[model samples]
Target: MKIVIIGSGNVSYHLAKAFQQNNIPVSQIFGRNESDLKFISDQLQIPFSTSKLNDADLYLICVSDGSVGEVSRLITKENCLVAHTSGSLPKEILAGNYRKASFYPLQTFSKSKNLDYKEIPFFVESEGEEDLELLKNIALKISKKVMVSTYEKRKYIHLTAVFACNFVNHLYARAKEISDSQEIPFDYFLPLIKETTQKIEILEPKLAQTGPAIRNDERVLKAHEELITDQEQLKIYKIMNESIKKMYEL
Candidate 1:
Protein backbone atom coordinates (compact mmCIF):
# COMPACT_ATOMS: atom_id res chain seq x y z
CA MET A 1 0.00 0.00 0.00
CA LYS A 2 1.19 3.53 -0.80
CA ILE A 3 1.39 5.26 2.58
CA VAL A 4 1.74 8.98 3.38
CA ILE A 5 2.42 9.92 6.99
CA ILE A 6 1.30 13.36 8.14
CA GLY A 7 3.12 15.46 10.75
CA SER A 8 6.81 15.57 11.71
CA GLY A 9 6.64 15.07 15.46
CA ASN A 10 7.59 12.13 17.68
CA VAL A 11 4.66 9.91 16.65
CA SER A 12 5.32 10.62 12.98
CA TYR A 13 9.03 9.78 13.22
CA HIS A 14 8.43 6.65 15.30
CA LEU A 15 5.63 5.38 13.04
CA ALA A 16 7.80 5.88 9.98
CA LYS A 17 10.67 4.07 11.67
CA ALA A 18 8.41 1.19 12.71
CA PHE A 19 7.14 0.85 9.15
CA GLN A 20 10.67 0.90 7.75
CA GLN A 21 11.80 -1.70 10.27
CA ASN A 22 8.94 -4.03 9.25
CA ASN A 23 9.70 -3.52 5.53
CA ILE A 24 6.53 -1.55 4.98
CA PRO A 25 7.43 1.30 2.66
CA VAL A 26 5.97 4.71 3.54
CA SER A 27 5.56 6.51 0.21
CA GLN A 28 5.96 10.01 1.63
CA ILE A 29 5.95 12.16 4.75
CA PHE A 30 3.82 15.35 4.60
CA GLY A 31 3.90 18.24 7.06
CA ARG A 32 4.12 22.02 7.43
CA ASN A 33 7.68 22.00 8.82
CA GLU A 34 10.33 21.44 6.17
CA SER A 35 13.26 21.02 8.55
CA ASP A 36 11.53 18.41 10.72
CA LEU A 37 10.21 16.56 7.68
CA LYS A 38 13.68 16.70 6.12
CA PHE A 39 15.19 15.23 9.25
CA ILE A 40 12.78 12.30 9.11
CA SER A 41 13.32 11.92 5.39
CA ASP A 42 17.10 11.87 5.85
CA GLN A 43 16.88 9.35 8.67
CA LEU A 44 14.25 7.06 7.11
CA GLN A 45 15.16 7.77 3.45
CA ILE A 46 11.48 8.43 2.71
CA PRO A 47 10.52 11.24 0.31
CA PHE A 48 8.85 14.26 1.92
CA SER A 49 7.26 17.58 0.95
CA THR A 50 6.24 20.76 2.71
CA SER A 51 3.95 22.20 0.04
CA LYS A 52 2.92 19.30 -2.14
CA LEU A 53 1.37 16.08 -0.84
CA ASN A 54 1.32 12.81 -2.75
CA ASP A 55 -1.76 10.70 -3.31
CA ALA A 56 -1.57 7.40 -1.50
CA ASP A 57 -3.69 4.42 -0.46
CA LEU A 58 -3.40 5.44 3.19
CA TYR A 59 -2.76 8.73 4.95
CA LEU A 60 -1.71 8.41 8.59
CA ILE A 61 -2.33 11.67 10.42
CA CYS A 62 0.22 11.83 13.26
CA VAL A 63 -0.36 15.44 14.27
CA SER A 64 -1.32 16.68 17.73
CA ASP A 65 -4.85 16.29 19.16
CA GLY A 66 -5.83 19.92 18.43
CA SER A 67 -4.37 19.78 14.91
CA VAL A 68 -5.89 16.41 13.87
CA GLY A 69 -9.01 17.95 12.39
CA GLU A 70 -7.19 20.86 10.77
CA VAL A 71 -4.55 18.55 9.28
CA SER A 72 -7.08 15.93 8.15
CA ARG A 73 -8.87 18.59 6.09
CA LEU A 74 -5.63 19.15 4.18
CA ILE A 75 -5.75 15.72 2.62
CA THR A 76 -7.81 16.30 -0.54
CA LYS A 77 -7.44 12.75 -1.75
CA GLU A 78 -10.60 10.71 -2.35
CA ASN A 79 -11.15 6.93 -2.64
CA CYS A 80 -8.44 6.43 0.00
CA LEU A 81 -8.24 5.64 3.69
CA VAL A 82 -7.30 8.36 6.20
CA ALA A 83 -6.36 7.44 9.77
CA HIS A 84 -5.13 9.47 12.71
CA THR A 85 -2.76 8.21 15.38
CA SER A 86 -4.33 9.63 18.51
CA GLY A 87 -5.40 7.67 21.57
CA SER A 88 -7.82 10.34 22.80
CA LEU A 89 -9.43 11.28 19.46
CA PRO A 90 -12.24 9.47 17.63
CA LYS A 91 -12.08 8.47 13.99
CA GLU A 92 -14.89 10.98 13.32
CA ILE A 93 -12.42 13.77 14.15
CA LEU A 94 -11.02 13.42 10.66
CA ALA A 95 -13.09 15.83 8.54
CA GLY A 96 -12.33 14.44 5.09
CA ASN A 97 -14.77 12.66 2.76
CA TYR A 98 -12.57 9.61 2.61
CA ARG A 99 -12.83 6.55 4.84
CA LYS A 100 -12.12 7.76 8.37
CA ALA A 101 -10.18 5.56 10.78
CA SER A 102 -7.86 5.61 13.79
CA PHE A 103 -4.56 3.75 14.15
CA TYR A 104 -3.61 4.59 17.71
CA PRO A 105 -0.46 3.04 19.09
CA LEU A 106 -0.75 2.91 22.87
CA GLN A 107 2.74 3.92 23.95
CA THR A 108 4.71 7.06 24.68
CA PHE A 109 6.75 8.01 21.64
CA SER A 110 10.16 9.71 21.53
CA LYS A 111 12.20 10.13 18.36
CA SER A 112 15.49 9.50 20.19
CA LYS A 113 14.31 6.39 22.04
CA ASN A 114 14.29 3.05 20.25
CA LEU A 115 11.32 0.84 21.13
CA ASP A 116 10.31 -2.72 20.45
CA TYR A 117 7.29 -2.12 18.22
CA LYS A 118 6.13 -5.68 18.81
CA GLU A 119 5.60 -4.88 22.48
CA ILE A 120 3.41 -1.85 21.74
CA PRO A 121 -0.37 -2.24 21.66
CA PHE A 122 -2.17 -0.81 18.66
CA PHE A 123 -5.84 0.15 18.97
CA VAL A 124 -7.52 0.44 15.57
CA GLU A 125 -11.01 1.64 14.63
CA SER A 126 -12.56 1.97 11.20
CA GLU A 127 -15.87 2.60 9.48
CA GLY A 128 -15.95 -0.69 7.62
CA GLU A 129 -14.73 -4.25 8.00
CA GLU A 130 -12.50 -4.03 4.91
CA ASP A 131 -10.72 -0.89 6.13
CA LEU A 132 -10.63 -2.14 9.70
CA GLU A 133 -9.06 -5.41 8.62
CA LEU A 134 -6.60 -3.44 6.51
CA LEU A 135 -5.45 -1.45 9.53
CA LYS A 136 -5.45 -4.49 11.82
CA ASN A 137 -3.31 -6.45 9.40
CA ILE A 138 -0.80 -3.63 9.22
CA ALA A 139 -0.73 -3.30 12.98
CA LEU A 140 -0.31 -7.05 13.41
CA LYS A 141 2.82 -6.88 11.28
CA ILE A 142 4.61 -4.58 13.73
CA SER A 143 2.89 -5.39 17.00
CA LYS A 144 1.88 -8.57 18.75
CA LYS A 145 -1.04 -6.85 20.44
CA VAL A 146 -3.72 -5.23 18.27
CA MET A 147 -7.32 -4.74 19.28
CA VAL A 148 -10.35 -3.22 17.60
CA SER A 149 -11.57 -0.60 20.05
CA THR A 150 -14.30 1.97 19.60
CA TYR A 151 -13.87 5.66 20.46
CA GLU A 152 -15.81 5.11 23.65
CA LYS A 153 -13.24 2.59 24.88
CA ARG A 154 -10.21 4.39 23.40
CA LYS A 155 -10.97 7.63 25.29
CA TYR A 156 -11.05 5.77 28.60
CA ILE A 157 -7.80 4.05 27.67
CA HIS A 158 -6.20 7.45 27.09
CA LEU A 159 -7.52 8.75 30.41
CA THR A 160 -6.11 5.76 32.29
CA ALA A 161 -2.77 6.31 30.55
CA VAL A 162 -2.66 9.89 31.86
CA PHE A 163 -2.94 8.60 35.41
CA ALA A 164 -0.48 5.73 34.91
CA CYS A 165 2.20 7.51 32.86
CA ASN A 166 1.84 11.31 32.77
CA PHE A 167 0.72 11.86 36.35
CA VAL A 168 3.22 9.32 37.67
CA ASN A 169 6.07 11.00 35.76
CA HIS A 170 5.01 14.40 37.14
CA LEU A 171 5.23 12.95 40.66
CA TYR A 172 8.74 11.76 39.84
CA ALA A 173 9.65 15.32 38.85
CA ARG A 174 8.19 16.62 42.11
CA ALA A 175 10.15 13.99 44.02
CA LYS A 176 13.31 15.14 42.26
CA GLU A 177 12.55 18.72 43.25
CA ILE A 178 12.27 17.64 46.88
CA SER A 179 15.51 15.65 46.66
CA ASP A 180 17.32 18.63 45.06
CA SER A 181 16.10 20.89 47.87
CA GLN A 182 18.08 18.77 50.36
CA GLU A 183 21.03 18.23 47.97
CA ILE A 184 20.14 14.53 47.87
CA PRO A 185 21.21 12.74 44.68
CA PHE A 186 18.05 11.99 42.68
CA ASP A 187 19.82 8.92 41.20
CA TYR A 188 19.72 7.36 44.65
CA PHE A 189 15.99 6.73 44.16
CA LEU A 190 16.47 4.88 40.86
CA PRO A 191 16.42 1.41 42.40
CA LEU A 192 13.39 2.27 44.48
CA ILE A 193 11.52 3.55 41.43
CA LYS A 194 12.57 0.57 39.32
CA GLU A 195 11.54 -1.91 42.01
CA THR A 196 8.21 -0.13 42.49
CA THR A 197 7.42 -0.55 38.78
CA GLN A 198 8.82 -4.08 38.52
CA LYS A 199 6.65 -5.20 41.44
CA ILE A 200 3.53 -4.19 39.49
CA GLU A 201 4.40 -6.85 36.92
CA ILE A 202 3.64 -9.55 39.48
CA LEU A 203 1.36 -7.75 41.94
CA GLU A 204 -1.74 -5.61 41.68
CA PRO A 205 -0.88 -1.97 42.33
CA LYS A 206 -3.30 -1.74 45.26
CA LEU A 207 -1.95 -4.89 46.88
CA ALA A 208 1.66 -3.93 46.14
CA GLN A 209 1.20 -0.46 47.60
CA THR A 210 3.78 0.57 50.23
CA GLY A 211 4.92 3.72 52.07
CA PRO A 212 4.05 5.55 55.28
CA ALA A 213 0.59 6.49 53.98
CA ILE A 214 -0.26 2.87 53.10
CA ARG A 215 0.91 1.77 56.49
CA ASN A 216 -0.93 4.71 58.09
CA ASP A 217 2.14 5.45 60.18
CA GLU A 218 1.18 8.83 61.54
CA ARG A 219 4.55 9.58 63.10
CA VAL A 220 6.52 9.00 59.88
CA LEU A 221 3.94 10.86 57.79
CA LYS A 222 4.08 13.85 60.11
CA ALA A 223 7.87 13.94 60.07
CA HIS A 224 7.98 13.72 56.24
CA GLU A 225 5.31 16.38 55.88
CA GLU A 226 7.21 18.66 58.27
CA LEU A 227 10.40 18.22 56.20
CA ILE A 228 8.65 19.35 53.01
CA THR A 229 8.93 23.14 53.29
CA ASP A 230 7.73 23.74 49.73
CA GLN A 231 4.01 24.41 49.94
CA GLU A 232 3.24 22.80 46.59
CA GLN A 233 5.21 19.65 47.37
CA LEU A 234 3.75 19.61 50.88
CA LYS A 235 0.25 19.85 49.45
CA ILE A 236 0.91 17.00 47.04
CA TYR A 237 2.41 14.88 49.78
CA LYS A 238 -0.57 15.46 52.06
CA ILE A 239 -3.10 14.84 49.28
CA MET A 240 -1.37 11.62 48.20
CA ASN A 241 -1.14 10.37 51.75
CA GLU A 242 -4.79 11.14 52.37
CA SER A 243 -5.73 9.36 49.17
CA ILE A 244 -3.69 6.32 50.12
CA LYS A 245 -5.22 6.33 53.60
CA LYS A 246 -8.71 6.49 52.13
CA MET A 247 -7.95 3.69 49.69
CA TYR A 248 -6.70 1.37 52.40
CA GLU A 249 -9.30 2.57 54.93
CA LEU A 250 -6.54 3.55 57.31
Candidate 2:
Protein backbone atom coordinates (compact mmCIF):
# COMPACT_ATOMS: atom_id res chain seq x y z
CA MET A 1 0.00 0.00 0.00
CA LYS A 2 1.23 3.52 -0.70
CA ILE A 3 1.94 5.63 2.38
CA VAL A 4 2.73 9.28 3.01
CA ILE A 5 4.38 10.66 6.14
CA ILE A 6 3.59 14.16 7.43
CA GLY A 7 5.82 16.45 9.52
CA SER A 8 9.63 16.92 9.62
CA GLY A 9 10.44 16.48 13.30
CA ASN A 10 12.11 13.56 15.10
CA VAL A 11 9.01 11.35 14.96
CA SER A 12 8.69 11.91 11.22
CA TYR A 13 12.37 11.21 10.57
CA HIS A 14 12.45 8.06 12.70
CA LEU A 15 9.17 6.74 11.31
CA ALA A 16 10.33 7.31 7.75
CA LYS A 17 13.64 5.59 8.47
CA ALA A 18 11.86 2.66 10.07
CA PHE A 19 9.56 2.28 7.08
CA GLN A 20 12.50 2.43 4.67
CA GLN A 21 14.45 -0.12 6.67
CA ASN A 22 11.44 -2.46 6.61
CA ASN A 23 11.04 -2.14 2.83
CA ILE A 24 7.79 -0.18 3.19
CA PRO A 25 7.45 2.28 0.33
CA VAL A 26 6.49 5.79 1.39
CA SER A 27 5.13 7.55 -1.71
CA GLN A 28 6.04 10.99 -0.35
CA ILE A 29 6.56 13.09 2.73
CA PHE A 30 4.63 16.36 3.23
CA GLY A 31 5.74 19.15 5.53
CA ARG A 32 5.97 22.94 5.70
CA ASN A 33 9.71 23.10 6.50
CA GLU A 34 11.70 22.66 3.31
CA SER A 35 15.13 22.21 4.88
CA ASP A 36 13.96 19.65 7.43
CA LEU A 37 11.82 17.78 4.91
CA LYS A 38 14.74 17.82 2.47
CA PHE A 39 16.99 16.27 5.09
CA ILE A 40 14.60 13.36 5.64
CA SER A 41 13.79 13.00 1.93
CA ASP A 42 17.45 13.00 0.92
CA GLN A 43 18.37 10.50 3.62
CA LEU A 44 15.43 8.16 2.97
CA GLN A 45 15.38 8.63 -0.84
CA ILE A 46 11.68 9.53 -0.70
CA PRO A 47 9.96 12.36 -2.60
CA PHE A 48 8.91 15.35 -0.48
CA SER A 49 7.16 18.66 -0.98
CA THR A 50 6.56 21.76 1.13
CA SER A 51 3.37 22.67 -0.71
CA LYS A 52 2.03 19.51 -2.31
CA LEU A 53 0.24 16.79 -0.34
CA ASN A 54 0.54 13.41 -1.96
CA ASP A 55 -2.40 11.09 -2.55
CA ALA A 56 -1.81 7.67 -0.95
CA ASP A 57 -3.64 4.78 0.66
CA LEU A 58 -2.45 5.94 4.08
CA TYR A 59 -1.35 9.29 5.50
CA LEU A 60 0.41 9.31 8.88
CA ILE A 61 0.38 12.70 10.57
CA CYS A 62 3.51 13.05 12.72
CA VAL A 63 3.14 16.70 13.62
CA SER A 64 2.93 18.20 17.13
CA ASP A 65 -0.22 17.72 19.25
CA GLY A 66 -1.41 21.30 18.78
CA SER A 67 -0.90 21.08 15.00
CA VAL A 68 -2.57 17.69 14.43
CA GLY A 69 -6.06 19.14 13.97
CA GLU A 70 -4.89 21.95 11.67
CA VAL A 71 -2.62 19.64 9.71
CA SER A 72 -5.31 17.01 9.30
CA ARG A 73 -7.59 19.62 7.79
CA LEU A 74 -4.96 20.23 5.13
CA ILE A 75 -5.45 16.74 3.72
CA THR A 76 -8.10 16.96 0.97
CA LYS A 77 -8.14 13.21 0.45
CA GLU A 78 -11.60 12.00 1.41
CA ASN A 79 -12.52 8.37 2.31
CA CYS A 80 -8.77 7.61 2.85
CA LEU A 81 -7.24 6.62 6.16
CA VAL A 82 -5.55 9.50 8.01
CA ALA A 83 -3.73 8.61 11.21
CA HIS A 84 -1.81 10.73 13.71
CA THR A 85 1.21 9.61 15.70
CA SER A 86 0.30 11.22 18.98
CA GLY A 87 0.14 9.41 22.33
CA SER A 88 -2.18 11.83 24.12
CA LEU A 89 -4.47 12.98 21.33
CA PRO A 90 -7.53 11.03 20.14
CA LYS A 91 -8.51 10.13 16.59
CA GLU A 92 -11.39 12.65 16.74
CA ILE A 93 -8.83 15.46 16.94
CA LEU A 94 -8.17 15.06 13.22
CA ALA A 95 -10.83 17.28 11.65
CA GLY A 96 -11.60 16.03 8.15
CA ASN A 97 -13.94 13.92 6.06
CA TYR A 98 -11.37 11.16 5.89
CA ARG A 99 -11.18 8.16 8.20
CA LYS A 100 -9.50 9.39 11.40
CA ALA A 101 -7.19 7.06 13.33
CA SER A 102 -4.38 7.08 15.86
CA PHE A 103 -1.14 5.21 15.14
CA TYR A 104 0.84 6.04 18.27
CA PRO A 105 4.28 4.56 18.84
CA LEU A 106 4.92 4.57 22.57
CA GLN A 107 8.57 5.59 22.79
CA THR A 108 10.74 8.65 22.75
CA PHE A 109 12.13 9.42 19.30
CA SER A 110 15.47 11.12 18.67
CA LYS A 111 16.92 11.58 15.20
CA SER A 112 20.50 10.98 16.42
CA LYS A 113 19.74 7.85 18.43
CA ASN A 114 19.33 4.54 16.64
CA LEU A 115 16.61 2.31 18.09
CA ASP A 116 15.42 -1.25 17.58
CA TYR A 117 11.99 -0.58 16.14
CA LYS A 118 10.98 -4.17 16.88
CA GLU A 119 11.23 -3.44 20.60
CA ILE A 120 8.92 -0.44 20.51
CA PRO A 121 5.22 -0.82 21.32
CA PHE A 122 2.64 0.68 18.98
CA PHE A 123 -0.87 1.58 20.21
CA VAL A 124 -3.48 1.94 17.51
CA GLU A 125 -7.04 3.28 17.67
CA SER A 126 -9.61 3.32 14.88
CA GLU A 127 -13.33 3.69 14.35
CA GLY A 128 -13.72 0.44 12.43
CA GLU A 129 -12.40 -3.12 12.64
CA GLU A 130 -10.99 -3.14 9.10
CA ASP A 131 -8.93 0.03 9.55
CA LEU A 132 -7.77 -1.16 12.97
CA GLU A 133 -6.51 -4.41 11.45
CA LEU A 134 -4.78 -2.52 8.66
CA LEU A 135 -2.91 -0.31 11.15
CA LYS A 136 -2.13 -3.31 13.37
CA ASN A 137 -0.64 -5.20 10.42
CA ILE A 138 1.53 -2.24 9.45
CA ALA A 139 2.71 -1.71 13.01
CA LEU A 140 3.48 -5.42 13.46
CA LYS A 141 5.89 -5.26 10.52
CA ILE A 142 8.22 -2.96 12.51
CA SER A 143 7.29 -3.80 16.07
CA LYS A 144 6.69 -7.03 17.96
CA LYS A 145 4.21 -5.38 20.32
CA VAL A 146 1.07 -3.70 19.06
CA MET A 147 -2.16 -3.15 20.96
CA VAL A 148 -5.64 -1.86 20.22
CA SER A 149 -6.18 0.82 22.80
CA THR A 150 -9.13 3.13 23.37
CA TYR A 151 -8.64 6.86 23.87
CA GLU A 152 -9.22 6.49 27.60
CA LYS A 153 -6.53 3.80 27.90
CA ARG A 154 -4.10 5.74 25.70
CA LYS A 155 -4.45 8.79 27.96
CA TYR A 156 -3.18 6.84 30.96
CA ILE A 157 -0.46 5.25 28.85
CA HIS A 158 0.88 8.70 27.94
CA LEU A 159 0.75 9.81 31.57
CA THR A 160 2.62 6.69 32.67
CA ALA A 161 5.25 7.37 29.99
CA VAL A 162 5.82 10.84 31.41
CA PHE A 163 6.57 9.35 34.83
CA ALA A 164 8.71 6.54 33.44
CA CYS A 165 10.66 8.26 30.67
CA ASN A 166 10.30 12.07 30.81
CA PHE A 167 10.39 12.54 34.57
CA VAL A 168 13.22 10.03 34.98
CA ASN A 169 15.32 11.88 32.40
CA HIS A 170 14.66 15.16 34.18
CA LEU A 171 15.87 13.64 37.44
CA TYR A 172 19.05 12.53 35.68
CA ALA A 173 19.62 16.15 34.65
CA ARG A 174 19.14 17.26 38.25
CA ALA A 175 21.59 14.61 39.40
CA LYS A 176 24.16 15.89 36.92
CA GLU A 177 23.68 19.40 38.21
CA ILE A 178 24.48 18.26 41.74
CA SER A 179 27.51 16.28 40.59
CA ASP A 180 28.80 19.19 38.53
CA SER A 181 28.58 21.53 41.51
CA GLN A 182 30.78 19.16 43.53
CA GLU A 183 33.36 18.72 40.73
CA ILE A 184 32.31 15.07 40.36
CA PRO A 185 32.06 13.64 36.89
CA PHE A 186 28.46 12.80 35.93
CA ASP A 187 29.77 9.64 34.24
CA TYR A 188 30.34 8.24 37.71
CA PHE A 189 26.56 7.83 38.07
CA LEU A 190 26.06 5.91 34.83
CA PRO A 191 26.78 2.49 36.30
CA LEU A 192 24.41 3.15 39.19
CA ILE A 193 21.69 4.38 36.86
CA LYS A 194 22.13 1.39 34.56
CA GLU A 195 21.95 -1.01 37.49
CA THR A 196 18.85 0.72 38.81
CA THR A 197 17.07 0.26 35.50
CA GLN A 198 18.33 -3.31 35.15
CA LYS A 199 17.14 -4.17 38.65
CA ILE A 200 13.61 -3.01 37.86
CA GLU A 201 13.43 -5.48 34.97
CA ILE A 202 13.83 -8.41 37.41
CA LEU A 203 12.33 -6.93 40.56
CA GLU A 204 9.26 -4.88 41.32
CA PRO A 205 10.20 -1.21 41.64
CA LYS A 206 8.99 -1.03 45.23
CA LEU A 207 11.02 -4.09 46.24
CA ALA A 208 14.05 -2.79 44.37
CA GLN A 209 13.84 0.66 45.95
CA THR A 210 16.80 1.99 47.95
CA GLY A 211 18.20 5.26 49.34
CA PRO A 212 17.52 7.35 52.47
CA ALA A 213 14.05 8.21 51.33
CA ILE A 214 12.79 4.61 51.24
CA ARG A 215 14.62 3.84 54.45
CA ASN A 216 13.14 6.96 56.05
CA ASP A 217 16.56 8.03 57.28
CA GLU A 218 15.74 11.53 58.45
CA ARG A 219 19.32 12.23 59.45
CA VAL A 220 20.69 11.57 55.94
CA LEU A 221 17.77 13.30 54.26
CA LYS A 222 18.18 16.40 56.43
CA ALA A 223 21.92 16.48 55.72
CA HIS A 224 21.35 16.23 51.95
CA GLU A 225 18.58 18.83 52.11
CA GLU A 226 20.96 21.24 53.82
CA LEU A 227 23.61 20.68 51.13
CA ILE A 228 21.19 21.68 48.35
CA THR A 229 21.45 25.48 48.00
CA ASP A 230 18.95 25.74 45.17
CA GLN A 231 15.45 26.18 46.54
CA GLU A 232 13.89 24.42 43.56
CA GLN A 233 16.17 21.45 43.93
CA LEU A 234 15.56 21.36 47.66
CA LYS A 235 11.83 21.42 47.10
CA ILE A 236 11.96 18.50 44.69
CA TYR A 237 14.23 16.53 46.99
CA LYS A 238 11.90 17.02 49.95
CA ILE A 239 8.83 16.18 47.90
CA MET A 240 10.42 13.00 46.57
CA ASN A 241 11.45 11.93 50.04
CA GLU A 242 7.99 12.54 51.42
CA SER A 243 6.45 10.62 48.52
CA ILE A 244 8.70 7.65 49.12
CA LYS A 245 7.97 7.70 52.79
CA LYS A 246 4.24 7.74 52.14
CA MET A 247 4.46 4.95 49.59
CA TYR A 248 6.26 2.62 51.99
CA GLU A 249 4.31 3.86 55.02
CA LEU A 250 7.61 4.61 56.77
Per-candidate clash tally? 0, 0
Candidate 2, lDDT over the whole model? 0.93
Q: What are the models' TM-scores?
A: 0.98, 0.98
| Best-performing candidate as measured by TM-score | 2
Residue pairs that clash (backbone atoms under 3 angstroms), model 2 = none
lDDT of each: 0.94, 0.93
Model 2: per-residue Cα lDDT over 1-250, one tens digit each: 8899999999999999988998888999999999999999999999999998978889999999999999999988797999999989989999989888999999999888999999999999998999999999999989999999999999999999999999999999998999999999999999999999999999999999899998778899999988999888898998999999999998
Per-residue CA lDDT of candidate 1, range 1-250, in tens? 7999999999999999999999999999999999999999999999999988898999999999999999999988789999999988989889989999999999998888999999999999999999999999999999999999999999999999999999999999999998898899999999999999999999999999888888779999999988888899888999999999999888
What C-alpha lDDT, on a 0 to 100 scale, does residue 123 get in candidate 2? Answer: 97
